[model samples]
Target: MWRELALGLAGPLSPMRQAQPVGFRAGQAVTQREWRAEVAGWAAHFAAQPGADVALYFEDSLRAAAALFGAWHAGKTVWWPGDALPATAERLAAQGTHFAGDWPGGACARVAPQPEPEPEPEWQPLDAQAPALVVFTSGSTGEPVAITKRLHQLFDEVRALETCFGSRLEGARVVGTVSHQHIYGLLFRLLWPLAAGRPLVAERQAYLEDLTRLDARLALVASPAHLKRLDLPDLAGLPVRLAAVFSSGGPLPDDALAPCAEGLGQTPIEVYGSSETGGVAWRQRAPGADAQHPWRALPGVDWRIEDEQLALRSPQLGSLDWFLAADRVRAEGPGFVLLGRADRIVKIEEKRVSLAAIEQALLALGGVQELRLPLLPGRRQELGVVLVPTAEAWEAIETQGRAAWLAPRKRALEPLLEATVRPRRWRLVSELPVNAQGKTTQAALAALFDPMRPSARLLQREAQRACWAIEVEARHPGFDGHFPGHPVLPGVVQLDWAERFGREAFAHLQPAFAGLDQLKFQQVIPPGACVELELQCDEAGCVLRFVLRSARGPHASGKLRFAAAGEGA
Candidate 1:
């Protein structure tokens, strides 16, 4: 692998060397030689610190590569913590010793950058099975799981790349908009180009305008998140040869694929794999291609079905045979079709329903850009959907009764019926929150739907100020043991709920809270408490008076105040 990279760098016969790949920015281009020098210098510096796990967090590709190679040459495991939250970083730091990519405030030795040499050494062969890269998987609930792969596994992934895209990528300059930390970015942006003896563009282009200034025939490695932002009409006139456009992280919405293909003149090649099993399959989003097939394993890799889930054993990871995956797949002649994750499927009222399937169906609807379907805890008959609607569609849904819009099963139900297992709450949104990989978190989805705790209270504007009432409700069935035995709603959850209610009430204003005064919890409101909340607004923000009421009487009561951040237009 290293040898090919070196040849691509120095060999006169190498296509990459002859082409002199350039990193295009606002209006300027940086040559491959300059990029190599910067990275080599960082490698030399990183080599000074032996055995220290280094975190590479640069936003720029050239800098990121330099930090990565530097740590690699130092023989230290490099941790690409992608866009992990601060809490995640603290958790990782607690688990192992780490050197930050950015300079520390108080450090001992400062390694100086070295000059580029005239003759580069021949690339040395790397042990295929030796641990080389560590990427993280966003765990289902809490901490992210760190998965390690050997150099050979990466090589196998590159081999898969050749089979899937060899025809299109010959002598193509590789440019990427995805982060180099994740598997998708690691394989497409760094390893694939290095293995194929192709020069990679050192900058990460975020906007379509930035990509347009570059030379044509470029292989763009991007994610569905990045691609979704592109305006097809703007990209249509650019000189993009578009050897291939690769997307991963999540299923690329079909609506996005058609226009992007029409604009770029090439169908996007989507890769399906995870942190545990490197590269699994590749499929082009052509007109009639099966949207559900598992990627054909590379030449040497073997695949089989274990308990309805796909299992793979590759020569890349020696001694490790049959790594089980979460994806559910069925045989399709030479290949297999993916049927979503087995874990993502939930059983509601004896009916098996896949949240991913429901979300896909909702996305297929007109003006629905993105949607999330999460089963509310303890509610066997209830489901919640957070949807982002187009401006026109948003108006239509608001004007047309929300219940009227649903055909039958898609609508909410009052009394739990045998056949009424559809989503109960449908929250309209301008945009959905997505993680770095473009996947939404359960917590984020819950925030969109529930917004506030039952104990919290806020003021709402009615037609007149003649009436005031304390409304309290417990809708979350999971609220029972959000804590152990002394289950009281979390403070942050209460604050989130208040903010959500305020945002809805004062849609035109950005509401802020000065403070909560005389906040008292009178009683324990268990899960499933139907509560009512009333709010009164004055110059000193809005005051919330809430009561968690049951069928008999009030279960709990509380007051909250929300101050407007600043004067609004």
Candidate 2:
């Protein structure tokens, strides 16, 4: 195979015939020739536009790739925002960028299917020094910041990826659960496959079962959060072993690694880098591996310790100068074991505390399944923990109360954590909120403490339905004036909640309220009670059915009717 086909990027991706099938667009095979014509058409269209910078957003990876390369081919710089949300579009438009591909703002340009080139369609070589992309940080730390990447940086990283893992993934079909809007998804799902001549499945996989249903010779680009909750039952009926599996955002959790490797018949390559670092190092969890398993650097990447921090100089940085990273590491033979982030340290009452240490201490508890510590800002800053409790603990919480659930766990942490730095507020949730990048940002973690939002955690979701875990505390606003001493969830509040959660679970709900039928308040839901709210949408009849139940008994159940579209306000 040629160098470009085997381990190169950008110059001539996949040294193969244009007529060969490059990928699948929504399960339909698209030849490289057709893709070239699309790119050419997009290039011509954008080339005639005025601005040098344009904001691009697309749910379809092929369309995204076409627009990306087309924008570059047209000598235009691209601002790759993390989502197609209205706010994101407005922000990009404020920067004076023309919107392209599925954005809600302006007259967003859509890709023209079966576009014809004025002349013969051809792939043009992109300049290595060109300003290629401006991507945002995952906002895991704080507010998201913008980082620009030169064409050479992308070219270098893809080549590095090919050099590192090309052999194992040769001729594989790339599929992913992560969106292409994010940097990790863009690289692993689209760019890497393009460079390797691998076929890419356009649509993002929703359920874990969706990934397993595909045919042989597959490479799945996934996130750690997605893999951690992997139920082994979902892996059943898989016909063949995947060629490779790549995880970004963070290292795969210890429990998740074994099942993935054993079940998939391949060790998942966990890339340890962020949007800022690009691809720094990668490692696979071996049998009985712990923190002892170190991350090895990619080709052409150099790493060194500077003041107990990991410093790197990668081609992805587009600079030869060593860039110091915030993460602290203990050097192994040639690789390094990540200790924790140095910036996660906080001070309380003249005492320094490692927030990461506090998290580790809580995670060690059997009752806590997953948790995130969000720094609650006030006159005096304090730490608040959002916990997704274990099944047994949640059962106890549901029966006893949220306070009852948190009391013993907080007591258990007394030995491992300092009193000053311990979590001041505890919020039980079903899952951590994640952004489009499959990462939980600082803002998201903090939002759990918001009083206005429903104190409910969505436990399960299916088409036209969702299950939420609701905890009504003694001090709940709904219990304020409902006959003080005998405070119970009000019937009117139950009706209001049904409508609110109903709209959230079912997207097809009309804006206007019509009426209700078969509404019943069976039992009194006392204060400090935990319950499950099941909302099922009957789209055909425009009725939303809700059932609120717990271990005690059924509290409320109702069928809510809604007006059709434009029927009422």
For each candidate, give its TM-score against the true structure. Answer: 0.58, 0.62
Best by lDDT: 2
Candidate 2 lDDT over 66-157, as tens digits, reads: 78877887888999976665545656778888778886634778874455445444445666787778997523343346789987788789
Off by over 4 Å in 2: 1-16, 122-124, 138-143, 237-239, 344-569
356 in model 1: Cα distance from truth in Å? 17
The local distance difference test score of each candidate is 0.59, 0.75
> Largest TM-score belongs to which candidate?
2
**Model 1, runs deviating above 4 Å:** 5-19, 22-33, 100-112, 116-125, 139-141, 288-290, 293-295, 317-320, 344-569
RMSD of model 1, in Å?
Answer: 18.1
Error of 1 at 490 (Å): 34
Q: Mind giving the per-residue lDDT tens digits that candidate 1 earns over 365-397?
A: 567766767666541335787766666775675
